[model samples]
Target: MTFLAVARLGRYTAAAEVLGLNHSTVSRRIAMLDASMGGRTLVRTAGGWEITDLGRRAMAAAESIEASLRALGEQAGGDPVQGMVRVAAPEAFTSAFLVPAVARLHRAHPGLAVELLAATQRVRQNRSGVDLEIVVGRPQVHRAYATPVCDYSLRLYATADYLARAGEPRTVDELAQHPLIYYVESSLQVDDLDRAVQRLPASPPSIRSTSVFAHVEATAAGAGIGVLPDFLAEHDQRLVAVLPDDYAHPLSYWAVVRDGPRSTAVAATLNALDEHVRSVGVG
Candidate 1:
């Protein structure tokens, strides 16, 4: 299972999550498998894990066996809804919203297990091993069942201490004079934050991070004004919105599923996600 997962996802960490094992365990299993075959099954490179030709053949055979087993189980009337649901999302949204929502989902359906894949940025294309992918902006995949589930907005924010010390900017022009915190230009995947900065004249930022959670933390620690998602920083007592009228940027969340018949578990999980979004009124 671990070998198959690695071949599919191209990352040991992601494969580990799907297999319900630690990354080291996944690596160990792969190593053992390689030893059993007396050949290199996978190679680790700068990009990530890559399966060899032999490994690809092995993966195909494994998948065939898995499909046969699944068909047999279904014929035996196995519990279709009782299984794992892997969800992938951006880090900030996942930590702020999806985690709690998934917890509620598990409470409602204890048989369903969830594996969350939190990425710092979105890529145009990659080997994703998750069942459901909740993209903050538009997903690049055209063949999948992608839909805009909800929309959320981002706004400029600062810590109360920073505001008190530096004085809050009242307008976009004034905001240019103050230090800013934002995502690194080269690494940004979502257009929402990019749009927020584009609305204002370019200013030198005091801090730049790839992670939105890091932006929130730096802003809360009095680093500088940061453009953050409303749901991520709304309830925090330390952070306050600034230039709400001029700085808010709207962005949509999309749910992407593969092209196929929906499994009972996947459908239920997707429904739970949509329900959670509506319940929170973040849209």
Candidate 2:
């Protein structure tokens, strides 16, 4: 009961309240859980508790046990393989790709459920309980599995109004005066990116964003000149290209996943992602 409550409520005190137990009792039960696993499973936080690495593993174990138990109940009826797949992806990815795929997945697999978590930060490995993560940049080949999804073409764009007001830039040198919106890059050095953008003779962007989607939306709203992925920019007639199509930039996108329990279901999902790659055409 304490375990279920803690997992449900995400805090010891709240779990204690839900279980109708004293706070100390809840504490003891959790400590027992730690002892059962031979280590601490969670760290106490001022606002709540964070599951430790071991706690994450223990949680998976508990889930597997529950699944086995449910399998027994399912055996009496017709049980298609059923489970919840947790996916971690950027807000843009959720909006652009994964969310649209959900409806078809549901129709194809009536019993399987997908839990999509929108994250502004880069998705960590399975240790963070994210079964799959889609990232925009170079694929991590070292991980259990990574597939290049698309080139994710990036180019300068501005709203029709913003461009009309500022006037279209005819030469690379003219870019210095206009307000531009850029992404504040990380992991990858911005110097190389800056050098490339400098080739266009642009003044630095007035507004910078970490989110590609945010940059796209802001540019469409006449915030400033910014880059947008082909998938996004192609759909919006309000946004126009600032640079020629031949302009060169470096970046890519990938879908990453950890090794799941060997199964046809997991393999099929990977294959599906691979198949989707071809459909993501170039800019």
Best by TM-score: 1
Q: For candidate 1, lDDT tens digit of each residue in 95-171?
A: 76788788887887777788888875554354556667777777787446777778888888898889899898877
Whole-model Cα lDDT of every candidate shown, in order: 0.76, 0.63
- Pairs that collide, model 1: none
Residue 268, model 1: Cα distance from true site in angstroms: 1.3
Q: Number of clashes in model 2?
A: 1
**Deviating ranges (above 4 Å) for candidate 1:** 1-78, 123-127
Candidate 1 local Cα displacement, residue 217, angstroms: 1.7
Residue 196 shift from truth in candidate 2, angstroms: 7.0
